[model samples]
Target: MPEKLTNIRNFSIIAHIDHGKSTLADRFLLHTKTIEERTFHDQVLDAMDLERERGITIKSHPVRMHYDADDGRTYVFNLIDTPGHVDFSYEVSRSLAACEGAILLIDAAQGVQAQTLANANLALHQKLTIIPVINKIDLPAADVDMCLEQVEELLAIPRDEVLKVSAKSGMGVKELLEAVVARVPPPETDPAQPLQALVFDSVYDVYRGVVSFVRVVNGSVKVGESIRFFNTDLTTEVKEVGYFSPGMKPSASLLQGEVGYIITTIKTPGDIHVGDTITGYLRACKQPLAGFQHVRPMVFSGIYPIDTADYEALKANIAKLRLNDSAFVAQPESSIALGAGFRCGFLGLLHMEIVQERLRREYNMELLLTYPSVIYHVFMRDGSMKEVDNPLHMPDPSHISHVEEPMIKSQIIAPATYLGAIMNLVMDKRGICLKTDNVDHIHVMITARLPLHEIVLDFYDKLKTVTRGYGSMDYEPDGYETSPTVKLEILVNSEPVDAFASIVHADRAVYRARMICERLREAIPPQMFKVAIQGAVGGRIIAREDVRQLRKNVLAKCYGGDITRKRKLLDKQKEGKKRMKEVGNVNIPPEAFVAVLRASDDKG
Candidate 1:
C-alpha cells in the first residue's frame, strides 16, 4: 500500500518559549475539527499541569488531524509539537528529523530570538520545509512587519513564505493552514516494508503503561501483532493501537502516512527509546534509523528524598515514571548521609522538570531534589569514576588529579541599549564573550561560552530584570574543561544539612561562608532553642552562628473567657511548627532553605 502522500502533510510547530506554539496548535486542532472549540483554553499540547503552570512545553506532542479544504478535498495533517527551551534542544532535533516541514512561530513583538535562529537552523539542517508564522498579532507591542523582515533577513527566505496570523484572534489562521498544505511535503508512505514508526514522544499512564506516541514512517500496524522497540531487545504484542487527533482517538489501525499511538503492554521507560523505530514483526529492522545518537543526555542531577522515609517510594516512583520517557536514565545511587537517591540523567532541564513533576503529581511522591549538576570526569589516583549529579560527591584532589566541568554555548538576545548591563552580568557569571551582534539598532545578540554550573545562579529572573523583559536565552551543552572549583560544606550543629551544601568556584570560601550566614539568618526562622550554623572547609568552621531566643513572648493579659483563644493560638503555633523543619531542634522555614540554596547567587 503506497501512502496517500498527496493527502498527507507531516509537520511540526517550532518556536521560542511562550511564542504561542501550543496555543496555535490548539487553534489548528480546532480548525481541523479534531477538538471541540471551547474545550482547551491554555496550551493544549502541554497536557501536564506542571507544563501549563511553568509555561513551557516539557515534551514533544504528536497529533493527527483532518482538514476539509474549500476545494472539498480532505487532507490528513500530522502535527508534532516540540519543546522551545535550549534544555530540550536534542529532543527538538529528533522531532524535526521526524517531520518533513516545520511551522516557525514568531512572537509579533519579540522578533527572531536566539531560539528562533537555533530551531530554524535545525530545520534547515534537516532540510525541513520551513513556514514562518507571525503569532500574537493581537498583542499591543506587536511589530508584525518588523518580525517578518527579521525572519527574512535571518534565513534569507522569501517574505511571502511567512504567514502573519494571530493565533489568538483566529484571523489569518485558515491562510496559515493553506500555506502548510502547499509548502510542506507529505511523508513517504509505502507499505511494502514492515510497519515502522519513529517515536517522537511518549508518556506513562498507570492503566496503559508506556503509551508510545509514534509517527509512522512505513507499512501498517494492527492489534495483536508482535512489535519491538529496535533499540531495546524487548518485544511485545500490540495490545492496543490508536491514533491521536491531539486527543487519543480510537482507530482500528494506522497505515503509512499516518500518526498514531500504540500500547505495547511493556511498561517501562527503559523499554521505549525516542528515536527507536517500531516494526510489525519483532527483530525486523536490518539496521536502526539515523539521527538516533545525536540526542545525548546533557544535564545530570542527584535526585534525593527529603525524608529517608520516602526512599522506597522514591525508587518505586522513578521506576514507574521511566515507563514512558526513554531519555531518563535512573541508576541506583546513594550517599552515606543522604541514604539513597538516584543519579538521574536527562536530555535537558525541562526533561528534569517533567521527571520531578511526574513523580510528585502522578506518583504522589515527595522529592528532595539537589541542584542539577553535570557529569564531571575526574582522573583519580586509583582509577576514575564519572561523577554524576552530586557536587557533594565530587572526588577530592587526593582522589582525583584532574576534572572536567561541562560547558554550554549560550546565546542571549536583548535590546541593544542594555548591552553593557548584559555584558557585565554575563561576565560576572563567568561567561566568556564570543561575540555580540546589534539587531537593527534596537536589539542585541550576545554569544558566550559558560559553565553549566554558572547558569544555576538564578540568572533567569535577573536576566529579565536587567534587560527589562527584552532579553531571552538559548543554550546547549558544548564541551567540558578542567575546573579548579571545590565544594564548601555548610554544617548546622555538626550535622550536614543536605540542602545547605553549596558548590562554588572554590577561591572565595570564606566570603561565601559569611554570605551564607547572612542569607541563612534571613532564611532560617527565629528558634526557641539557640542553634549554631557553621560553614566549614573540612571539620573546621570558618563561619559560625549562634541563634538567640525566639520564644520571648510577653503574656501580660489572661482574660477570663480567653481560654479558647489561647488554645487556638497554641494549636496554630503547633501547626506552624509542623510546617517548619525541625532541622536539629531548629525550626527552619521553606523560604529559608531556598534562600540558603540561592544565597550564593550573583545579586549585584
Candidate 2:
C-alpha cells in the first residue's frame, strides 16, 4: 500500500442499542486526545440534546483522530458513529458505505442479540472487514465465554480473534485500539482519478446553505470548485471544504479516501440527495459510486397542527425537518375533521415518535398525529393493484378484490425460559414461528413471520412485558401477503372523522373499533345534547359509545307552578334540546385524537 493510503483508516462501530457504541467512540476520542480531559463529556459524538437525553445515537456522526501507535508511527483514524435502532438502520448503512471496515461490538452480558446479528449481516453483505469485539467486559454478569461461543456459532467468527473491552471503565481499550489499527484495512483508491465523492448525509444550514457530508472515493474536492450531483444533475459551487475535528475544521482540500464535508451554494431542501455522488463539473467520473438504497417508509400517519392557523408554519417546519432526515416523507394532505395537515411516512413507530418530538422541541410546533397505518396492496377485480396507506384513500369494499398487507421476517432473542411466553405473544400478534436456535445454554433465537400491521402497534411493549424485559427483536420487510382487511372509520354524531379512520385486519377490526370507541367516550366532553361515537366498517356499525348530555334543570324554580304549566315548560325544554342536537356539530378536541392514537396501539 502507498504511504498516503496506509496511514488513513476509515471504520465505524456497529452494534445493538445500549451496546456502548457511543461510549466506545468517546473512549476513542479520549485515548487519541482529540479533546482535552477537562472539556470532554460522555457521548461526545451525540451532539443533539434529544440523543443525550434518550441515551441513544439518532444520527451518524463522523470525526477524525490522529493516534500514535506503539510501533512509533502516527495514523489518521476516521470514526463514524452510527445509531443502533432498527428505524435508523438506514443511517447505519449509509455510514458503512463510506467506511472500509466496522467494529462489530457485542454486549458481553447480553451476548448475541437480534440487532447484533442484523448489523453483522449488513457489514458482511457490504464485504467490509469486521473486527468482532466484546464490550462491557467489566460487568459482573459479563459472560465472556458464552459471548465468544455465540459469536463463533452465529457470526461464524473464530473465538480466538475476538477482542474483549470495557468501554465504560476503559479496560483493555488500548489493546482494542491496537487491534483496530492492525485488523481494519486502509482505503485503497487513487487520488489521480476523477473527483467522485459519495454524499453520505447532508444538513440544511440557514447561513451556509446545504452542508453535505461526503467520502471522497477518488480524486479530491476543494473550495471554489464547481461540482455536480450525479443523481439530480444539479450544479453548485463549493463554498467550503472541511473535515470534522468532531467540529468543522476547515482544510485546504478533501483528498481521496478521506471523509469530510463540502458546503455548497444550493439552499433548497431537496436539491442534494443523501446517497448521491459528487463529481467535478468539467471532469466527471464515468460512473457514480454505488450509493445506499433509497429508504421506503413502512408506517404512515396524518400530522396536523393543533391550531389550524399554524398549517403554514407546520409545513415549513416539516420541510426543514425533512432536509435533515431523508427517510421522513411528507405531502400536503387535508382532513375534513382535522383541517389542513400532511400525510407523513416513517420507517417505524419509533421513528415517527422521534420526528414528532423533534418537531415539538426544535420547531416549537404543537402537532397532532393520527392512528398509524401500513401500506396495503389492494388488487382490484379488474386486475389492477393500488397501494393504500391512508384509510381515507381505501377503495370501496365492493370494488376491491383482495387486500395484501406487508409482512416482516422478525428475529427475537430472549432467555430460553421465556420461550413459551414469547411464542404465545407472537401467536397473539398473528405471527407464525419458523424456527428456533439456542444461542448458548440459556438464550435462544426465534425467527417468525408476521403481518406488519399487527406488530406496528404495541407488539414491542408486549414482547418486553411477556419476556420480563429480556426479549429483543429485529425485523425486515418480507413482501406482502393476501389478507382479509376492511376500512374501519370512527363516526361522531353520524359524521365520519377522517383522522380516526384506519385499515385494520378483519379479524381484529371489531376489537380495535371497540377500544377506540371507549377511548373516545372517555375523551370527548359532554355537550348540551348527547353525542354518539360509533366505529363502523362500511355501512355496518360494530362499536358504539354515547356521551351523556348535560341536562339543565328547567323546573328547578317552578315549585309553585300549576301542573299543566310545569308540563308545558318541560315540553318546551325538550323541544329546545332536540333542536340543539339536530344543528350542533361534535367538536373533537386534540386530546381526543391523542387518546384514540393511544388506544390504537392496544393489542388486537
Candidate 3:
C-alpha cells in the first residue's frame, strides 16, 4: 500500500512565538481522527496545564496521525511539534532537520515578524520542502493578502504557492492536509543501509530513564538490538521499539521513514541528548545519515535560591526537571552573595523565563534571580582566565586587567514611526547598527551587533517601551567579543553584596548604579537596625542609602497582665533576636532579607 507508506509525509509545524503553530497542530490532530475531535477545547498536545496556562509549548513532542486526502487515500502524518521560543532554536532546528518538509505558519494580521524570518531561514537552510501557510483568518485584523505578499517577497517564494487557512476556526485544514500530501515529498528511502536514526528530541520516563524520539533514516530497528548513541559510546539493548500510530497507538518496530520512541534503560538523563545519532553497533562505525548538526545554546543565566536553606532543594528539583527537558542546562555557580545557583544556558530569553517559572511554580521554591547574565570570558591579572557567570561576580575593570564581553547579532523590526526611538534605544544599549531597510508600510528592519550582557536583564521590556509595544526583537546568541564594560557592585553598609552586582557599559554605569540604589530602597525593607545600601565601583562606594529602623521595636507587653507577661515578652525578644539577620552590626528582621532579595524581582 503506497510503497509500504514510504511515500507517507513526515513534517513539523514551525512558527514564531504566539503565531498559532500548536493551535494549527491541534486542528490537524482533530481532523485526522487521532483523538475525539475537539476533545481538548484547550491545547491538545500541550498536555500539561503549565504549558496551556503559559500558552507556550516548553517541550517538543510528536503526535502521530493519518489524514485522508480528497484523492480518497490515506497518508500517515507524523506531525513533529517544536518550541517557538528562540531558546529552543536548536530544538526547532533538530525537529526541522528530522523531517523532509515544514509548514511555515504566518499570522495573517501581524504579517511577518523577526522570528518568522528566522524560522523561515532555518527551514530553507535545512533545504526543507516549505509550505507557507497564512493563519488566523477569523480575526478582523487579518490581512491575508499583505502577509502572503510579505512571505513571497521575504522568503522569495511565489504568492500563489502560499496557503491561506484559519487554524482557530478549523477552516481550510483539510485542504492544507491535501496540500501537504500533494506538495510535500515522502521520506527519502534507502532501506538497505544499516540503521542510522537521528534523535531529534527525547524525554525521561520514570520506569525507563530516557525515551528517545527518533526519526529513522535507513534500515529498521527491532527489539533487543545493541545500539549506541553517537556522542556517547555508551551501548544499551533496546528494551522495546514503538512507532507512533494515529495518536500514540502501539505499533511494533518502526521502519525507515517512521517517527517513533525507543525505550532504553539508560541510567541517567545525561546519556540522551538531542540531535544525537542512534546507530546499530556494527563491524565498524557506520557513517551518519544525510542530515544532522550540532545545536548550540544561545543564551545563559544563573539560577539561585533566595534562601541558602533552599539551595540543595533547588539543585535537586533542577536535576529532576532537566531529565524530561533536554534543553534545560545547569552547572554550579557561586556568588559572594547568592552562594550557589546554576549558570544555565538557554536558546533565548523566553527559554530562560520558562525554566525559572517552572522552578518557582512546580517546585514551589522562591528564588532570588539575579538579572540573567550572558557568558563572558575575562582575562585576569594572573595570566589565567575565568568565565563570568553572574555580572555581580565580574571583577573590577582594574582587577580584571582586561575584559571581553559577549556580543550577539540581533534583528529589530519596528513601525516606521518609532524608527528614531528604536535607533536611539539601540545606540543607548551599545548596539552597532548593521543594516536598515523599509518593508511593509514603513516597517523597518534594523540589524545590530549588541552586547549580550546589555540585553540580558529586561531588554524586551525596554525595547517594547521604547517602541510603544511595536518592537519585535530577535537575536541568536553569537559569541563573546572584546567590549568596554564596568562591573558595578551593590553593597549593604559598605559590604559587597554579590547579588547586587551587574555589568553595564562604562557610560551607563552611573545611571544604572543610581537606579539600583533606588530599587534597593524599594526592595530593602526598613529593618530593626539601620542598614546602609551602597553601589560600589572598584571597591569604592559610588551610591549609598541608609534604610531607617522599624517604626516600633520588638516590644511585647500586656496592658493589664502579671509578671508572667514580662517573662513571655523576654522570651519573644530573645526569639526575635535569634531570627534577625546580622548585616554589618545591625540585626535586621528575617523578612528583611527576603524583602530585599525579592525586591529586584518586584521591580522586574
Candidate 4:
C-alpha cells in the first residue's frame, strides 16, 4: 500500500502570463501518450471557447499521466496547470494546495515579472518544493543566462537546480519530467485512515449534477458510500468516483494521495463550496483539513439585462457560471434607473470583463453594466459600522462619521529606462513609492501603495502604455485607511440616477465629475426642453453641462407680421417651454451610460 503512494508524484505548473504553462501541459500529455496523435492540438487543457480565443487559461486544469522513467519504473504524475494573471491568483493558490511541488517557469525574453515573484512567494509560503525552469528558449530574444542569474539572485534559488526547456518545441521536457519524479517527494498518506478529501475545484453538469475535483489525503472514497462536506455539513451518497486522464475515466475508488472527481447527486450549485473537505459520513475525521481562506470580492458592479423578461434566465445562468467560478458573486438588486438586475462582484477588472463576456457568449444574454466600485467602510455617528459597495446605499452625511477605503500594496516590474514614467504614473493614481530595486541591468522593480479605487479602472493599461508593453503588476490587499470621501451623484434634469452615483475622494471629485458631465453631454441627444446634466456632491453642484433644446422656430411663418404679433408668439412659445421643462421625462439612452462608464475608466 505504501509502495503505491510512493510512485505518485503530484505537482503543478505556475508562471507569469504568456510563459507557456498550457503549452507545457500539452507537451506533457503528448509525450506521455495520454492523448492520441490525431486528437493532439495546442492548449488541449483550455476547453472553454473564450479561453482558446483569448489564449489565456482562466481556470486551473488537472490531468493524470503515467510516465515510464529512465530507471525502468512506471510512475503516475498528477499535473495541474494554473492561470498566470493576478486576478486568477486565487485559482493558482487552490491548485498549489493540491500539489506537493510546483514548476516555476520564467520567460527567457521577459526574465522575471511581477506575478512571477508573487506566485513564487505564495508557493514558498505553502512550503512546496519549487523547481525553477526557463521557458521559450526558441524565441529570438531568449536570454537563458540572464534568466538563470536572475532566478538565483532575485528568487534565491541555486543556479545548478534550474532547468531550461522550450515548451513549444518540446525540448528537454523528458528530462524535466524525470527531474520531477526525482526531486518532488511523493504524497505521505495512510490508506487505512478514514476518508478525508480536499475539494480544490468543482463544476456542475446537467446530467451528473455537481462534480467535485478533489485530492484524497487519507482512506478511499467509492461509489454508493455516504460522504459529508466538512464545511457545509451536507451529506450525500457518492454516485460515482473517477480520475482525469485528460477526460473523465470512472474508477472503482480514488485511493490515498490520488487526485480525482466525485459525482454527488446534489443539483443545487451553491451546495458544494470550494475549499470544503469531504469525509466519511459514518466515520468522520476529528478535525477538518486546513481549507483555503474565503475569497473577498474587490470590485462591484450592476449587471442588468437589456430585456427585463430575462431576469430568471439570467439568474439561472449566473448560478451555473458560479458553479465553476467560486470567486464570482451575485445578488439580486434593483436600480431606479436600470430596473431589476443583479449586483455582481469580481476579483478585478479583467475578471469582471470575462464574466460579462461569458454571459454574453455562453448564455446569449445582453447586459448593461454600471460603473464599478470597491467596498467602503462607513462609520456612522451613531456608533455603528456599515459596509457599502453600492453608492445608493450610502448613509446621509449627518449620520456618517468617516469613510475608510481599501488600499493595496502593488509590485510593478518594468524596463529601467521607463522608471521615471512609471513613477509618475503611480503618483498620478494617488500612490506612494515605497522602494525600488534593480533586478538587472535593464529591468527594475518598484513597490508602491495605492488606493484600490484608483486602480480599479485603467491603471494597468496605463502602466503597460508607459513601459511599452513590458510592464507587469501584482497587488495584495492592505487594511483600510480613513479617507475623506463624498458621494458623487449624477442628476439628469434634477432627478438623481441611482446607477450613476459613485463614491469619490473629496479632492478629486471635481475632476471626476467633469469627466462624467462631458461624456454625458456628448452622448445625450437634444431634448424638447433644455436638459441639465449636473454632478452633485452632498447636494452641492460641482460640475454642470447643458444639452441645448430643439427649437421649432415659431416665427418661421411670420414673414411680415406686426411687432406685437411676433412678441405674442415668442411669449407663448416661452410659456410652453417652461411647462415642458417641468413635466418632461428625459429618456436617457443606454449608450449614454456606456459612454459615462468608458470616460470614468480613463479618469478613475
Candidate 5:
C-alpha cells in the first residue's frame, strides 16, 4: 500500500561542484539501511563512471528511502540528488520543482562559491524551503564557523538554524535525518483531483523502452491504465508503475505526492519529454502542471566519426543518448573536410566534453570533434536573419550586415588574493564588470557579462590558473548583443578547409588568424611543394604561414661535376616544385584540426 501523503517527504540536495553532495546521499542511504554496509560503496547515487571519476554529478538521480523518525513513525523520503555544475542548472531547477525542500550543501573549507549562490536563488524562486548544511567538517582545514557566517550573509539564513554534518564519517547523520523529517513538510496533493504527474527525468532501456521518472502531484496512477502526455497528446497504456528503492521496484499504484518511475512501453523517445505532464486518459487534467522552461544550448560543435563508415552508428547512438539527455541537440551536417557529421548543441563546455566522452566510451566509437562555437544571429543585407550554429554555415561577410553573439551573466567566486588577476582576465575577454561583493575578509565574488564564445574556449582553465584553483564560476544566458564579427577562414594551398573556419570578433580576428595559422604550420607536415596556409576574411588575407617543401637535393649526386650539370639538376627541381605547387593537394592530418581548437592554449 502507498504511504500516507503526510508521511511522504520529497526533497533534493543542491550544492556547488565538489561540495560533497553525492557523499551526503551515500550517508543517507546507509543511515536508513537502504543498502547493506558491506554492499555500500562511495558515491552510490552517482552511478555513472564519469561522474565517479570526475567527482561530480552530471545527472540528477532520485532514490526513495524509508526512515524511522524520532516521532515513533516511519516516513517515506524521496531524495533527488542533483548535479552541481552550472551547465546542469536546468536539471537542478527541474529537480527543485519536484521537491518540497532542498538541502544546500556547502564545503566548510571552501565556503560559499558561485554555484552556491546561483542554486540557492533557484530554490528560493521555486518557493521551496531551504535547509543549509555545512559538510566536510572532518577535514583538518575545515572552517565551519566561517562557512556558517558566509551562508548567513549570502543566503540570509539564520546561523543557529543551519545544520552541521560530516558525510564522510557519518557524524550527525541521524540528527540530520531527524531534522529532515521535522523541518521539511510533506508533499501537498489532492487525491480526489485528476491524475497529473510531473515528468522530471526519463531514461530509455533496451528491454523496457521509455521509463519516465515522475513526481505525482495530484490523483494516482496504476498499472493497465491509459495515460496521455499533456504536451505530446499521445496516449499509451501503462505497462508498469513503480518506486525507486535506489532501484526500480514494482508497485500496484502510485498515489498523490509520491515519487516513482512509470513504464509506458513507448518506443519513440521524442513522444515522452522531460517536464511534460502525464494524466489519465479518461479524466484528463484540464490544465497541465507548470512545466519547466525549454533549455537552450549555449555551445555548439560538430561531431563526426573518424571513419565515415561509422556515420550511421554515430547517428543511432546519438538518438539513443538523447532519450536520456534532453538538453543535447544534434542535426545532420556535412563538411568538405570532415565528411558527414552532426552539428551538436550543448549547455556548456563541460557538457560537450561529457557527451563526447560518453560517445567514445559508452558507444565504443572513434569520433572527431570540431572546435566548439556559440550560435550567432546573422543579419543579412536583404533584411533577413540567419542563425549560424556552426562556422561552416557562416554567411559571406559581404552579404551580411552584422552579427549578434550570445552573451552571458557570469559570476566568479574566489580568494581575495586573485582579484586583480581575475579582473584582468575578464576584461581581456571583452567582459563588462557588473558588480563585485566581498563575502568576507578572505573571499570575494565578481559578476560580469561576457560573450558566450569567450567562455566556451579555455576560459575555465584560465580562471583556475589565475586563481590557483581556489576560484569557482557560474553563468546564465543574458541574451544577445550586436557586435562586429567576421568569419575567419583557413586556406591550405589556396584550398579552403571548412573545418578550420571560425566566427570571431572583428577586432580579434587578426590575432586569432595568426594563432591558427601558426598552429597549422606546426601540425601540417612538409610536402613536396611549399604549402601556403592563409587566414582570410572574405577576399582579404589577414594572416599567413608557409610549410616549406622537403628538399631532396637531386643536385647532391653531382659531386665535383661541372656547373652545367648542377644547373640542369637545379632547374629540373625548381620546375618540379612549381608543377607540384600548381597541382599537389595538401593532406592535412586529423590532429591538425584538433590542434587548431587549442591554438590559444598558451595565450589564454
Candidate 6:
C-alpha cells in the first residue's frame, strides 16, 4: 500500500437534471488529458445509448485521473459521476458513500433546483466536503451573480469563494480541478488494519461474471486473495482487480483509500449485492460498514411477452438482468389475459421504463406491461394482513378491512408564475400542500405529501405540462397512510381482465373507472353484436360503456320483398344478434390495457 494517501482525492458531482454535470465531467477528463482530443465525445460517462439519447446519466460511472497542480505535485483523483433523476437517488446515495467530497454544480441561469438541495442534504448527511461550482456561464442567459448569491444563501458558502466554470467552453475548468484537490480533503487511510472495502456498486460482465466497484477504506486487496462478502457470506478468490481509466484496466492491487473494481467470477449477481462489505477471509473486519439497507422496490407492474412462446426466454432474460441490477425485483405470476409472465418491481417509473427498454433492445423481445402500481397493505377480516404489489393478488373486499397506501414527501421547484397550476395539479392527485418557500422573486419551492401511487402514473408529465418545462421535482418515501381504497376491475363482454385491474382510492374510483371504460370503448373494435365494457368494484358495477355493433347487410339482400318477409328477415337477424351476444368474445387491443395511463383530463 502507498504511504502517502494524502495525494488522492475521491469526489462525485451532485447536481440537478440538465445542469451540465456530464459536461463538467467531460471537461475534467479533457483537462487531465485522460482521453485524446480525437476520441473525446460529449457525455463520455453516459455509456448507455438510452442515456445519450435522453441526455441523462442512468448509471454511476467511476474513473481515475492524474492531474498535475501548480503546487508542484501530481494527484490521483477519482470522480464518480451520478445520475441526476429522482428515480436514481439511491444511486446518488451509494456514490456519495464512496466519496469524501462532492462538487455541487448549479446552473448559472436556472440556479439551484429541488434536486440540488436534496443532493446537497445527502452529501452533508455523509459528512462530505462540498465545493460549490456554477456551470454554463457561456450561455447568454447565464446569471453568474444571481447564481452566486443563491449558492451563498442556500449553501452558506461565501459568494466570492464559489468557483465558476463553463463546461462547454473549457473556461475555468483548470481552476475547478485544482479547487477539488485544494478544497476537498483526501480519504483517511489505515493500511495496517484488516481489509474493509465498501461495495458501492456492481455490474455484470458476460465473460468475467460480476464486477464489484469498491472503496478500500482500511486495508488492501489483491488478485490471489480470498475474500468474503459480509452480507452474503460468500467466499471466493479474486480473479482480477483493476481501475477504470474510463475503461477497465488490470491493476496489481488496490490499496487503502483507493477506489477500484474487483472481479470474483461470481456467476450470480444477486449473491454479490451492492452496499455489501468485502473483507479478507484471513483477517476479516470486526464490523461491517454502516448505511447498508436492502433496496425495497416501490413501484410494480406485470411484464409479459407479446408472444407466449417467448415466455420462458423472457424469464431467463430477467434472471440475467437481475444478476446485474439488484434493485429490480421480479416474481412468477400468471394473468388470465396476459398469460404466464412475471410481476416486476422497480424503483420508479423511469427505472421500469429502462428495464423494459433493455428487455426490448438488448434481448430483442416484445413485451406487454400492465399499469404500474405501488405496494398496498391489506387487512383481512380474520385478523391477518398481507402486502400486495400486484392487483391480481388483491384479496376479496368481503374478507378485507381497510387498506393503506404508500405516501411520499415531494418537493417541486418552479417559476412562481405556475404556482397555482402546479398546486392544482398536485391537489388533483390527492397531494396535500405542506409548505412553500421563495428561492428568489421569480422561483419558488413547494413541498407536499402525496400518494406514491398517484405520482407513479402521469403526475410527472402533468407537472411538466403545468410548469412549462421549467419545473423539477424530487421525492422520498414518507411512509404509508390509511385510505379508503378498492380494486377496480375492467370486464369486456362480462369477462374480467386481470391486466386492467387497479387498486384506486374510493373517491377517484368512479372517475378512473369511467375513464377506463371510455378509453376501452375507443380502443376496442366494433363486434358483430353490442359489447358491454364495464368497470366493477367487487360485484358492483361502477362505470359502463357499450360498443355498438357494426351495421349488417341482412336487410340489403332483401330486394322488393313483401313487408312480412322483410320483418321476418329483420327478426331472424335480431335473433342471430342475441345468440352472438351470448357466445361472442371481445378481442381487446393492447392499447386498451394502458388506456388509463393516457387519461389526461380530470373529468374522465
Instruction: Tell me the alpha-carbon RMSD of every candidate.
Output: 8.0, 2.4, 6.4, 1.6, 2.0, 2.1
lDDT of 5 at 602: 40
Alpha carbon lDDT of each predicted model? 0.76, 0.89, 0.76, 0.90, 0.89, 0.88
Using lDDT as the measure, name the better of candidate 3 and candidate 4: 4
Runs of candidate 4 exceeding 4 Å displacement:
190-192, 309-312, 558-565
Per-residue alpha-carbon lDDT of candidate 5 for residues 160-209, written as tens digits (9 for 90 to 100): 98999999999978988888888898888765689999988888788988
Candidates 5 and 6: which is better by TM-score? Answer: 5
> For residues 327-394, could you state the per-residue lDDT of candidate 3 as single tens digits?
66788889765678887877667777777788888899987655566667888898988877567556
Quality of model 3 by C-alpha lDDT: 0.76
From the highest TM-score down, the ranking of the candidates is 4, 5, 6, 2, 3, 1
lDDT tens digits by residue: candidate 1, 265-324: 786655676777887565375666677753567667677776778888888888766665
Clashing residue pairs for model 4: none
**Whole-structure CA lDDT of model 6:** 0.88
Worst lDDT run of 10 residues, candidate 2, spans: 595-604
How well does candidate 1 score on lDDT at residue 213? 78
Per-residue lDDT, model 6, residue 140, is: 96
Model 5: clashing residue pairs? none
Winner of 1 and 5 under TM-score: 5
lDDT per residue for candidate 2 within 1-604, as digits (tens), equals 5787888989999998888999999999999999899999999999789988888888889999999999988999999888888887777777888999999999998888899999998888778999999999999999899999999889989998999999998998899889878988889886568999988788878888888989999899989999999988999999999999889999999988899999989987577777789999999988888844667899998899989999999999998898778789999999998899999999997899899999999999988888888999999999999999999899999999999999999999999999999899889888999999998888999999999998888898898998888899999889999999999999999999988888988988899888888888999999888889999998999999999999888889887957998899889988998899899988888899887776646566
Clashes of 2: 0
Model 5, stretches more than 4 Å misplaced? 1-3, 557-569, 598-604
Per-prediction tally of clashes:
4, 0, 2, 0, 0, 0
TM-score of each: 0.84, 0.94, 0.87, 0.97, 0.96, 0.95
